[model samples]
Structures are given as C-alpha cells and as structure tokens.
Target: MSYIIMEIKKISSVETYPVRHEVLRKGKPIETCIFKGDDDEQTIHLGLFLDDQLVGIISVFKEQNNLFSETNQFQIRGMAVLEEFQGKGLGTKLVKEAEKHCINLNANVIWFNARENAVPFYEKLDYKIIGDSFLIPEVGIHFVMYKKIH
Candidate 1:
C-alpha cells in the first residue's frame, strides 16, 4: 500500500472556487461557484492538500439561519473533495478543522444546505436535518442540516 501526505490549512475564498466548481458545479458556469459572502472579513476557507496538491475544500461564514436562533452560528458552504481523492476521510478532516476554527471564533453552531446525496455523509458526521428537503433552482434537492460544534 502507498501512503499519502495530507495537510489541512486555512485558505482564501478564491482558492476554494476551483474544487467547488469541479466537484459541485460540474458543467455549470464557473461563476456558479462564487458564493455570496465569500469575501467577507469573518468568513474562512479551508483547503485539504495531498502531497502538496490541493484536492479538497470547505468554507465557513459567520451567518445565522432564521430556523435557528443561535447568536454565534457559522454556515458551512462549498464543501467538496476531488473525485479521485474522495471517500478517504479527507472531507471529515476538513470538517474537523473547520470545527476547530469555529470554536476559536466562539461559534456555537454550524449549518448548511446539504445536497440530497450528501445527507448521509453529513449524518455520519453527526449533523441532523432541520426540516423537509427542498429544491434549489438549477441545483436539485437539498436539506438544511446543522450541528452544535461548541
């Protein structure tokens, strides 16, 4: 068996767009990967690198959802791992790193609109669905999922 060297680090929002577009918005306009608040001062983007090559990414924004009244909540968005590098616990490592960052910011909760197929993945990470699944125009179905990370 071969070993892979991985490193997780805080990255700029722009650094996340490439993997986000490739994995989450394939065949769609590159602009689709540019999320709102990506440039916010309080937002953070995390990238997972394997052998010095970026292969996974996730972003966290200081935002609150109306569904939850938590004063210090961070929204997780644009989480994606490259097709070849997926299913190897890289996504979990990215999330664990995000949680550490969130805790440092005093955030009590983290939430996101998770794609339907990704529900089980989030569930495995202890995130729970908040309500019924809904459709995102041109994106397909999703559910609001959250976890108390504090």
Candidate 2:
C-alpha cells in the first residue's frame, strides 16, 4: 500500500454524531446516536480525518463495568468508520488512539459492548469476551469485550 496521511485527534461529542448515525444507527432515530455520557467532562471523542474528511470516529467514557474488578475502567462507545474506509485499518487506528488516552488517565481496562458483527474486529485487537451475548433492545445482540490497558 502507498503512504497515506491519517489524522486522529480529540473532537467534540457532537462532531461524532454524523459518522455514528451513518455507520451505526442507520434507520434508527438521530437521537440514538447521542450516548448518555457523551457530554461528560471526562469523555473523549476521537476523529480520524483522512484528507480533512472525518471518516472514522470513536468515543470513550470513564465508566466502570461490574464484570471487571478494575477500579479505573473506560468504556469505548460509538466507534465507526465509513463503509468506504473499511478494510483500510482505520478502525484499528482509532481504537489504538483511544487506548492511549485511557492509559494517560490511569485507566486499568478498556471495555465495551461490541455488536455481534464487530466481535471479530475487536478480537483481532486482542480484546476478550467475558460473557454470553445479550440484546440491547433496538441495537440487536452484543458481547461485552475488554482489554487490559494499564
């Protein structure tokens, strides 16, 4: 593959809506893209800009899961990359950036409820599944996946 310039930086939560809506929420209402802790002070949104276009986005919140014993945990949510950017490794890059930020905040683990179709993607990044898949109402089946980051 030829060289390409990729820019991933901290972005506002609102800036993540479009990408998440397009890639994750599709026919669902726009309000579905607005996560509960999106506007929290400790939440961080990362955007992957390819030639100035926001092709990938990820949001991380400082939330703990009872499944994990770690006191400092971060949950990654609303991670998406445009269809055109798929298979280009952009998703992996976005996740790595999130992990870096979580580490800086002394986060001991990074976890999220991965959509069934996305399980392979997170598994490739070394995340492990903790329990049986569960339904997320309108969102379909999901698995709780996590990776120790400290």
Candidate 3:
C-alpha cells in the first residue's frame, strides 16, 4: 500500500507566489498575485504540501471590512489549489486549518471576496454572502462572503 504524505503549515509570503501565480494569477501579471498586506507581520500564509510538493496555498490577513461590524476580523486572500489536485478536498483542509488559526487569534469573523463560481464552495463551508456581486477588473465578478468565527 502507498501513502500520500500531506502536510499543512505556515509559510512566508514570498513562498506563496509560485502557486498563487499559477493558480490565481494565470494570464494576469505575476504582481497581481501579491496581495496588499502579504508582508505584514501578522499576516498568515498556509501552504499544503503533498510528499514535499507544494500543491495549495491560502493567506489570511489581520484586516477588517467596514461591511462587517466586528472590530477584529481576518480577511482571506489568494486561496487556490493547483488545477490537477482540484476536487480532492485539499482546499477544504486548508480552509479548516485557517479557521482554527483565526479562532485562536480571537477573531470575530473571517471574510473574503469569493469569485462567482467559488461562492458555492464557501457556502458549503458555512460562509454567507454579504452584498451584491461586483467586478474586479482583471478578475471576474465576486461577492463578499463571511463566516462568524466567534
């Protein structure tokens, strides 16, 4: 029997670019993958590795959305799983891990701009849409989604 070794842990912001660019930026400039608060000391980047190969990544920042009443919130940004590994539940694992980290930080909620198609994925995770959908220029339409962690 063969076993697939999978591990998830904190990684530096710089370590996330390759996967981010490949999965999220695609045709856009690589700079588009570098989120605004990626270098902040409090920001958290989590990478999923399978047998030592980085296959997925998710970033969380200590940021608040005015749409949310919570003073303490963490915004999820640049979450993606390599195309070949999609539907394997690795994305769900990364998100669950992030939720644990956010809860530990005493966050009242966690939110993000969910791409139109990704809204269903977030919905399965118990995230709810906050407002009307909007466009992101290079990216497509997105809706603000959030889940109360407190």
Q: Name the best candidate (by TM-score).
A: 3
Error of 3 at 138 (Å): 0.9
- What does candidate 3's lDDT look like per residue over 24-138, in tens digits? 8898787787889999999999999999999999999999899999899999998999999999999999999999999999999999999999999999999999989999988
**Cα deviation of 104, candidate 2, in Å:** 1.1
Tens-digit lDDT track of model 1 for 42-147: 9989999988899999999999899988899999999999999889889999988988888998888999999999999999999999989999998999999999
RMSD after Cα superposition, model 2 = 1.7
TM-score of candidate 2 versus the correct structure, residues matched by position: 0.95
Worst 10 residues of 1 by lDDT: 9-18
- Candidate 2 residue-wise lDDT, 19-105, digit = tens: 999999999899989999999999999999987899999999999899999999999999999999998999999999999898888
Candidate 1: misplaced stretches above 4 Å? 1-3
RMSD of each: 1.3, 1.7, 0.7
The lDDT of model 1 is: 0.92
TM-score of each: 0.95, 0.95, 0.98
Judge candidate 3 against the unseen true structure and give its global Cα lDDT, from 0 to 1: 0.93
Query: Which model scores highest in lDDT?
Result: 2
Ranking by lDDT: 2, 3, 1
Each prediction's whole-model lDDT (CA): 0.92, 0.94, 0.93
